[model samples]
Target: MTANWTTYRELLLPGLTGRRAVESELRRAVRDGRLRPGTRLPSSRDLADQLGVARGTVTSAYTQLIGEGYLVAKRGSGTTVTAACSWPDTFERAPDPAQRWRFDLRPGLPALNAFPRDEWLQAQKVALLALSTDELGYPDPAGFPLLRAELADYLGRVRAVATRPSEVVVVNGAAEGISLMGRVLKAAGHTSVAVEEPSHFGAADMLTSHGLEVRPIPVDDKGIKVDVLSTTDCRAVLVTAAHQFPLGVVLHPERRHALLDWARAHDGVVIEDDYDAEHRYDRPAMGAMQALDPSRVIYQGSASKVLAPALRLGWLVLPPDLRDTIVERKRLDDLGTGTLHQAAFAQLLKTGGYDRHLRRTRQLYRARRDALLDELSRVLPDWTPIGVAAGLHVVVRLPAGVDDLAVQERLARRGVNAPALANYCRLPTFPGLVLGYAALTPDRLRHAVHELLEAL
Candidate 1:
């Protein structure tokens, strides 16, 4: 079957077109079923050579087809036909046929390649050298005293959260924070939690897994609607106030006030997930919502976005009353986050190394994001990349009736790793793909954009 491509091409030569010839050939291939859905196309160099055309011409042809939803590309894999239109509906079902893509653009991740391995190792070595014998024994259930103090100071300065050593509970990461909070909140007689529509599905799912009724609150360009929130009888609302996941809209000052007011009036608590607030590329960064009303907001921040997710380091600033309950839950759960890593992180913070690392990565990510936007502009004229101000991803909204999920499945079959935005939403809405750019190089980005357009 693979050899048939060249064997058939010899009998039917494909003419080269400096302009519209490529587009015409693409249309012909799709019509004739020569390039069926989920069919992996050859690389630009290979295709260009096979068709006896320049590589730029191949790129142009693929770009045109991608816009029209004919092909797709993924990281580490070349192009392929969109499986939705060409194969069975289950074509390109996610988390399957692993290694199908050549490029991955899914959101909510930092570039693991850029982790500060040397600096972290140095900090760990220093901490270990200075450690007392007693430090290695059974750790404090709350957290390492040094890490808690460091987080207390750091959150105070950057996030303006009313954090203190005693009130800060360290978990393995934000996931644990959610679980701990859910456990405590459930124990306190809260059975329902209101979440943002199109919110972090992972978080919302976690809430549901804990047997709490999950209600969806609508989100506008500003942030989650505060008026609709008052209608619900929920005991808590989980919010990504600083940089809302997927959408990347910062909760405005007025909305923040509204949220705080709602929390105070309803005797409700706000679980703030400050997920990627540190990697701001737009205006000056905003502080945590807990700053406005500490008692009503349980502030959660993690090193996942800035450093890496594998660190499993996160802190929760709890109200004075719920502090003991959350800590006890943490103790019963994972015992506690490791002492040495906490100590090393503390040293990284105090010595100014972590801040410097963040500054460097922020600059690199900003450059990569610019490259992705620029490529989108050049390759995709009609399509606009939304939510470009901050975060690792940009949303490309296709015109109405585009079926972004279908287009995404098609792209995946073609070897591109872009996921549809519809996957995140619990309710039906617009069709778009979330394109993450932090981990890709400029050359890789250009190739991905070209392949994406071809797959579409």
Candidate 2:
């Protein structure tokens, strides 16, 4: 299909003043199938004359289009649309009407809609302007020095984590921190690590993938059974001491002492995931277990729950002995996390912006949590909510003979999303739903609870 000069020249009549504008018109024509494959175009000189534009503009457009595979120009051959150019008929896949939900109650998410964008942008601007030329070069693998120093001070003040700036290593997120720790432990001749039963399954999978046998230790209202962990042949244990995932119970004070004692007795290690300690509502914030025995415990904390998950910013306060190996592992993993983000976060901490944001979000999340509980009580009083003292989620225990997975599926069909508690466990123990209320407003949560009841 050879396009004559008159037919194609008319297509380029509008908005053909600049080289880029000419290129855009031609590109659009080719993409929309007006200039079909194998259609020869007019000479650049002829097109420029016809469109009343400079010849160089047409030539530049031709060169760009040729480079983009939209046009082919060869020596001793005229310019033509590429024979291979094909635009497929594209359509968006329609969503399943039955599966479209009005609310999402799945766990481990922050209220992203409430993120402090202006504060973060201002912080970034300040950090960049304040950065010295030497500071912008290849970043220190451990972390940005300012960020490490600020985080050291902040963690000590807020979580009672005892560590110096030299002891902290910034990584991508909590997941990468766990992976790095697993590799470090594996290299140290450790074969097995114990994890809380019905915990975040991703932790277990990461340990197994790193060639460590994962032994599950059951968790009750008091958190992981330290007695059972003592009996295991594992040399390391991963725990969410502040706020247990999916279950939400704090590690009891007695269990905390027993865990440290067991670690001391066997020369073992404890990996503490202090994921959402800052979101506590009902009581004083619990200090991290790492404060008790920094030599035997590795403390990991992330900004995912407080700030935004997209930040992928987390830090590890390592025991002095394990510091070198973990830093080496991080250096080999990704060199280091983004330097600019670390600097900005450090600014947020130093200027008290981060703390202010935390104070605001804590209150907002507490209100949402209360609303969710109230709605659940009014709609389904038989279902009991557990672990409401801290964190963004609560587990609602279903009545006898009710299947949690079945309820989850039913909720999905009725436009509500709630994950079954069994999904997080290696072995089934109870039927329940893990509901997160932080991401949605109170009205949306109320409507979702009503829908969930209808599904039930």
Candidate 3:
């Protein structure tokens, strides 16, 4: 195991002519197991001579590698690859990983390419500079106060969520917000909750893991069937009322009232996941379900669709009865979400940068959706698009008898990752596909449609 890398020196080493190149090659060799644990590297002088690089170049690379714990150097032992010298192989253009984005029409992303990097950086810089030393420490378990205030104000103004700063809870993402609610519900002796029939599978799993049964009430074009929801003995339900997930239908005004009435009669709670509320195209998204009766509804929204998901920032506007207890759970969960991101976002919201970002992305996403729909119409006229003109994805129902999963598999073989509608359901229902179009261009979407037709 103590073999000197000088052996490969005769092969790959000869091609390395700079410090970075030399470092990268060694890193790759270690990753590929060519330079395994305890494999000594050639001396800097030796490597420099072998690779036609300056001696300092090799020495600096070796020094940096030693610092990174990739190599261990000793006076007499020389530099050798460490036992723990493992890193992701960023150098490799391996097929499996690269194949993830063949067509990449998978849902749950906005126009990530439209993120305002310059504006964000400026806001972050200003916020970080103004942070007092004490402010850098652990944030409040509920959220950074200023961020909560900003979010409360923004939600009230934009989504008509009737919440004050005290009601706001920052979460890593909408996923965590759901998990927190699941814990709260389970602890309150709630044995079951309901979700939309073809709702987010992962959210249901979270509830199930927390010892709650997740009942799925079927939805129609107008939204969740409140009559079915009332029949269920569950005391709580999660709904995507602004624009239903997978289906893309907004809750009809009458249905919304009926759903709220059922909640009141059953003494139940409503978890309104206002996902993709920021990207409405044809018309303004309806005001949040939380506003009509904040006492009965727990509203959740996230920056994932409007901004990048990498930000991992989401908010919950909770009713007073649930706020304190969930805040306690959040304290136990991760102490608190990071303050730096919260403060930076607060600055963005305060300065109107967030609204500016949404405005730009709204236009961009609308165009992308149009492009996708236009292509699909031309290529597959028989397929019908469902849902409102909003969000990052569109669900198109295929003609009767065409198995969506089989079509999905065929598309996979050709490098597309779009999901069949059936994949999100607990009960079998539709034969369709959910295609995310925000990440691709007009031309690329047209091309993807061609590929989809071929797969068909």
Model 2 per-residue lDDT tens digits across residues 103-203: 67878889998888999999999999999999888789899999999999999999999999999999999989999998889999999999998888778
lDDT agreement with native, every candidate: 0.78, 0.84, 0.85
lDDT of 3 at 348: 95
Q: What is the C-alpha local distance difference test score of candidate 1?
A: 0.78
Better of 1 and 3 by lDDT: 3
Candidate 1 lands at a TM-score of 0.79
TM-score of each: 0.79, 0.78, 0.79
Summarize candidate 1's per-residue lDDT along 1-456 as a digit string, tens digits. 274456434532467745356666665665567667777776655667777776545664665465456665654556667676553333423323234347777677688889999999999999888879999986777889988998899888877778789988888889988988887888889999988877767787677778888998887789999999988898699988887777777888999999988888888899998888778886778888888888888998889888888889998898888898888888887778899988899899989888999899889888888888788889887676765378777787777788675566567556576867766676776777888888787778888999878876
Better of 2 and 3 by TM-score: 3
| Per-prediction CA RMSD (Å) | 11.9, 17.0, 14.2
Q: What is the lDDT of residue 300 in candidate 3?
A: 96
